[model samples]
Target: MADFLNNLRTFVRVVEAGSFTAVANESDCTPGQVSRAVTSLEEELQALVLHRTTRHLSVTDVGTRFYERAKVILADIDSATDEARNATESPVGRIRVHSSPGLAYSEVATALASYQASFPAVSVELKIEQSMPGLVEEGYDLSVVSATQLPDSAYISQALGAAYSVLVSSADYIARHGLPRKLTDLADHALLQLESPVSAADEWHLQSADDTHLWTITRTPFRVNTPDALRAALFAGVGIGTLPTYTVADDLASGALVRVLPQYHLRPFTVFAVYPSRRYLDAKVRTLLEHLRATLSPALANAMEIVETFTGDATAPPASPPKRVAGTARKRPAKRK
Candidate 1:
């Protein structure tokens, strides 16, 4: 009965549209195709739904009655279909996300705020760490990490965006110490380093056209384990520090900090959202991923614009060489000897 009613509505649309050709155009099909579908539907119901001529079309008395009831049935069918699709795809339940302290506070937090508003049924638990947490060990459903390369693991990794590290300092620091016009000039100036446990302890690597440079000396007078702390220190005129473009975008915009080495570029790091393997993932994760993909595209584009605004360079420098550090080791003594 429902199937017959559904077809009856299609027949009615053809009649209202004035001709099968008009209905076919509206339905994105050929006139003959629409005609055949109507014919098949009529045969299945053992009823002639319309009186058609080369000039016009008119619904029969039975067709007119069926159209009145068929519209209601068709509306109900559409409502049911929409509900089913929404239930299967809607973001609901609890989701756990782990991210770096910097991103957690800046982009990730903002993205979650909008996501929450759009999907009220979903509850999000965010954990901020200095480094990417072990997804299985920490029991996180998703983790955002910045890395040069993704390891060969069972987890799925999607690149949310990319950013490069830049040496930056407060205007006061530069005014007092003077900006270093060359890479070698930094040896005489103070440097601030990120002391995250999960990151390499080696020298900061920089790249230029056909040249690779490494600044390894701990000439860094101040060091912090987190990006937030590093930003605060830099804001306080601690020293020249290397940070991601997104992290310093606002500060750079406000003229609180200025780019130091405009010629040399640090290696570009990729931001990835890692998730466990699953044949049928939960709707919440899928929806969040979609939101992230859509939301991050424009954010990343803006980040690139900020980079260009600060660097004043049109071409990106070459990639830097990989440097090993104490952080990557499996285990280490309590203190460095």
Candidate 2:
């Protein structure tokens, strides 16, 4: 019975990941072993579930039906197990979390450490990448994603907090290139662009109290997809680029990186904790979300406060908060430092 359940879980993972090797890596096993688990299940059921070839693997009609049922069965079993264990046991299990490189470095990585310290039995594996991965397909228990608008999906998203980006350049870069005196002068300078979910690649819409300006860069001598890489390039005096204030808060405070046009910043966005099956959230996932809200909420608020401080508007009354579109901020103050 236990072996059958293990096989069922492995089969579900293989179907979602679309690769036996991927499931094997998650399980810390070999591909052949994972393939054998599927074979064993097929033999037990006396039916073919998948079409296999050296270069192609597809679900059969029967496999698709079986996959759906098996997924529900596993989810129910997990829900039941968690419910039974919750009353007496501390949350104990391995949690796989996916996050973008910037947020992982600036926030989630540290939060996970404190979470584990409190729940000593819970172990975590963090995967940092630029793209969002399927929570179930990639075997991630949760994903901490920062974006202006989250792509439509079935996963449940809990807003961790709001965050925003700002234009920044190293002091040395300013010394070498000379700061832009006005928006038009940016055209003559080395404008670094960091590609992120919330930022446009070739242009930026910088917002101030009075109005918004569309500043477009004609040439990007250096363009990067990750925020950290962009930050490094700025440190190297590659060009002036925008960064999440939280990622560069220390740098700005230490005068390592100086904010450009402190009053004008990119639009604000929300950081979300996304996961599968809101109804059956495992105790571990639920507690982790709560911990994040407590820790990251203040951190993000502090980031916004930092922006206000440097912009020399700390004493002014806060502007009207922007209206949310699709449960996310459309345009607001930068929340993450």
Candidate 3:
């Protein structure tokens, strides 16, 4: 409380001044107000910290013990304030960042390069893991998470991009088994699954032009929780699997994997950079998050752009007949004599 912190001040003053009126005079407040501050502190703590009579005031055992600890707390606060004031001209602190493995592999490392180069004075301690560490609980300044929605109310979510899952398989596997002509065609193919709560890993919903298609598998060759693992299985030609686009965008461009149903959309795993309450956002945290938004979002979008070029819109009708060149046919080669 604003008034409560000063009560610690008033308590110490009363202990040193040894009189309510004397303490009040030094603090330039009414004796009654000074008396109330100390009284409220005791009431708040449920401890009788002081004994006061008309002319005499004394500290009780609790008051003496509290005074020692309160002095240390006040001193620490003063030191923190001094450091903050001194660094007002430039940001200089270690920003602890935690990120989900998916993002850590995809964009966090790329963004951190420019971020560190830009803010040389601010150091970073980054942990790339799956744990959903709270901003305050785990002393994290920021976190990048792969989730469809906000993880908690205590933090603000800055959407970086959407996590797109696409059906893919190695080129060799597709050349061997053949591409599925439609959703139903998947029933005959070997499928690798991801452990999912939205539905069984074997169940998939794909959005078509005017309707949505749902396919369930009675037989699955493999199932895993992380997208990277699913991608690994697909790369090994284990089976056709659904993998996030962020993780496989490069592979798609290099012809390592091909999209099965380019026209349909898979469930999106939304992306967010979560940070503590915005009220106290510091310079270092602000700069790093800005860097992430500027670089990571565009990189992911551009990578996925390659995938989109192959998939063309599902609702749009098939490409119209190719326009023919008018009167531009090549002349026949002269017969040899």
Candidate 4:
């Protein structure tokens, strides 16, 4: 019976490929062997599965129904084999992870380093892309994403943390343009804008305890599609820009960029670790998620501090301001009440 079932599987493969030669090539056997297997399978089932001509193979209605059943059966057998192997093995397998390029460089890369160190048996393949790929169709075990909310899908999402974005400029630019003490003051300065996926003119919206404010400031003097490029531009004193705190922690610490509007804050964005249904959850995927959760908690705390240093409090003793240089200072008349 086992031999018969094996031969039936080979017949199913040949039927699916639509040619004995193709199935033979895939199964690493001769076309004659595939023909024999199909013949044997048909004898056992007492039904003709294919109508063969000189040029093509056509499936009968019964063959079509049998093919459908065989496909499901083959899938179940594959799943069973995988589950059984996982029960004994140390969860060793290749895990493919997809993430946004900016987050991949900033946070995901660090998290993966620790994860790989801890799980020596598992291998990770990370791809940074802007488009959301289908997890199952693409055969990715996991993905990390930052978005306003969880996407509606069958995939399971675990919240890693919240990302806070803030408007920032180089200390030199702020010194040259004068600080924007209020939302209205933003119009007077060169505002570096991030182009959205949907449109070019989307404005940065900010909120505070008392009220919400929208600024239609000028677009970035030089626009780039990526967050890393925007960060570089801000560092180079291109213009004031908005970005996630995690992407600019080191720069903020070094005073390369200073946060604007310390009084009002922008809305927070959510980060999620998403994966397909847990049925085929590989060991690498589980370990990666664990590592990320453990590592990102403190990292997120530090990121919040960057925001706090700018928008929350500056009670610490002030450091000496930079020396005035060309295009580094703005002359403005005193405001009248």
Candidate 5:
């Protein structure tokens, strides 16, 4: 079986290389050995897998069909091998992660790179999505989200950290228009908005020392679907708009953008790592959660607090494992939510 698999791989390489001699050269083997492997595979399958000549090689009709199916089988076998090995090995499989584009722009990308470096055998596919998908149904290994509430489903959830959106404007805009002293003052300022299921692009939900109110802008200069684009507009001095702190932490430090309202925040955007209900969690998923909880979550959730309290007076967070947070029978929220 092992020899057959090797021959199958050799066949694939030969097809791609277009010559047994080329494949043998690459493999540091003789051309006859490569030809023999393919010949053995053909004999076993009783089909003409390839037609070879002095200068060219082409797949026969049977070879084309066999090659198509062979690739799938080979991939399946590799995945299965990884799964079985990972049972005893460390987390070593490809983890499919879904995250909001805004959140992903922050510590998520950094955390992923760090995790991949720590676990070189593991791979990750981080998809940027605004809508949270059903984990089990959609085949997502994990979902990283920032929301006030998550859909009550059969998934276990954990509070990675507390994140929030802040109203911001270009330094030039703030310099030219002056800062708004009150929430109502925004009525006179230009605005940019992002449309999502939970919040209307044109509507702003704000809370100040006095009260919480939803204000709809009369005139929106730009309404973009992406946080990145909205940020660009803010950079161009389009108007004042709310953006995730993670998206603008560096900008704030650089003085490119200034927080429009320091006293008021829209709402707490809590970050959560959600996964499907299962008897056992995959190591890849578990390690990713661990990494996020330990690193990204804290940095992301507390970025505003850090930026606000840059007096160099704040103490560092305790070096203990984070509390797994949730709303259902699974792990629930820590003190974070």
Candidate 6:
């Protein structure tokens, strides 16, 4: 159909030029190809469009009427193509983004605000949930997800950054229950659990260097499904739990929460910006993605470095502003049981 559309275009040009050679030269094709284009169109319509003689060519009554209608069709198609091509330059549309609860709460807000400030013509709708929604089925323009390994799917994934989770507890809780000096001591203290898609509900996988330890949760006084709730539980001096460094950086800095086992951390997972396709990516989505890569990735990297520096040292002074860190640091791979 696309080729046939080109033929229709050639026929229109030939009618206006009154010579196949003229249109052929303009199109940079042979006069034979130009003539074939008209021939194909004539065969499809099963009518003679041009009365040809050795000296000249004239349009029949049927050809005259068809030419007018075909001209309008081609013009409309050209107009539509131009508008679509220019959409990337002036983006104006609503973008619906889906994200996990923890990331949406802690990370996406500032990036979204900054993006809106720059591109005031684009509006965004953010939805947060624990489970992953089908991007196309659910009408999502993009999704920000964190996982150890993404399952096989049709979506395109871009790694924004990677960060490890830190085990932390409130100072008051440590004072009341006594600080856990070793991995086994954690069994004696109340354990608050945050159930997440990438985490197990009944166990915590702790790793340091090449050694890995699995701490089974036999008893738990508090278990929640969201990162904010888990952080709140930790703040209330309920028990110790693990949180992403980005989520607890300020708390650790402010002495609201102290690192528990600084040497060991939960497995690091990547944050990904997922979308349906890379071909002709919308300007609204592309700008948002670029903004996040510039802002959010660096923020996560800085948070990891800041938290790593203060690890195992609970008496450290208030943290200064974190400096930007480039490149990922090497760590032992997580061994999950």
Residue-wise C-alpha lDDT for candidate 4, range 1-337, written one tens digit per residue? 8878788788688776889899988989898898888778888889988887778888889888998998898889889887767844455767789988667777777777667777777677999886568999999988888777765899998888777677787776876778787788877877776653322335777877788877665444776667777877877777777777667555555566677776765577777889997775566676677777787655655566655655443222125322222221121222111
- Predicted structure 1, TM vs. truth: 0.65
**Per-residue lDDT of candidate 2, residues 1-337 (tens digit):** 9999999999999999998999989999999999999999999999999888998889999999999999999999999887667723457778889989888887778788888898888899999988789889879999998988888888999887887888888777888878766677787788887788777878888888888998888788999999888888888888889888667665665456777777788888999889987775677898888888888666766666655556743122234422112211112222223
Tens-digit lDDT track of model 1 for 266-297:
77778888898555676777888888877754
lDDT of 3 by residue, 1-337 (tens): 8778889888888888888899878878899999999999999999999998887888999999999999899899889888876554456878888877656765676677668888888888889776567679789988887775564486787888776677888776777887787887888899998864233587777765678777787888888876667777777777788766666665665556677778775766667888887875677877777788787777666656655655753222224422112221111112111
The better-scoring model by lDDT among 2 and 6 is 6
Which sections of candidate 1 miss by over 4 Å? 1-88, 196-199, 312-337
Against the true structure, candidate 4 reaches a TM-score of 0.68
Better of 2 and 6 by TM-score: 6
Ten-residue region with minimum lDDT total, candidate 6: 328-337
RMSD of each: 14.2, 16.0, 11.4, 12.7, 13.6, 6.5
Top candidate (TM-score): 6
lDDT (CA) per prediction? 0.72, 0.79, 0.73, 0.71, 0.75, 0.82
Which candidate order results from sorting by lDDT in descending order? 6, 2, 5, 3, 1, 4
Worst 10 residues of 3 by lDDT: 328-337
Residue range 51-94, candidate 5, lDDT tens digits = 98887799999999888889899999999887776754478768
**Per-residue lDDT of candidate 6, residues 1-337 (tens digit):** 9878988898889899998989989989898898889999899889999887767978999999999999999999999898778666666778899888878776776677777888899898999988879999989989998898899999999999998787888888988988887898987999888898777977788999879988889889999999988988887888999998877776766667789878899888998999988889888888889988988888778778778876656645335735434322212112111
TM-scores for the candidates: 0.65, 0.68, 0.67, 0.68, 0.66, 0.76
Best candidate, lDDT: 6
Clashing residue pairs in candidate 6 (N, C-alpha, C atoms within 3 angstroms): none
lDDT accuracy of residue 146 in candidate 1: 73
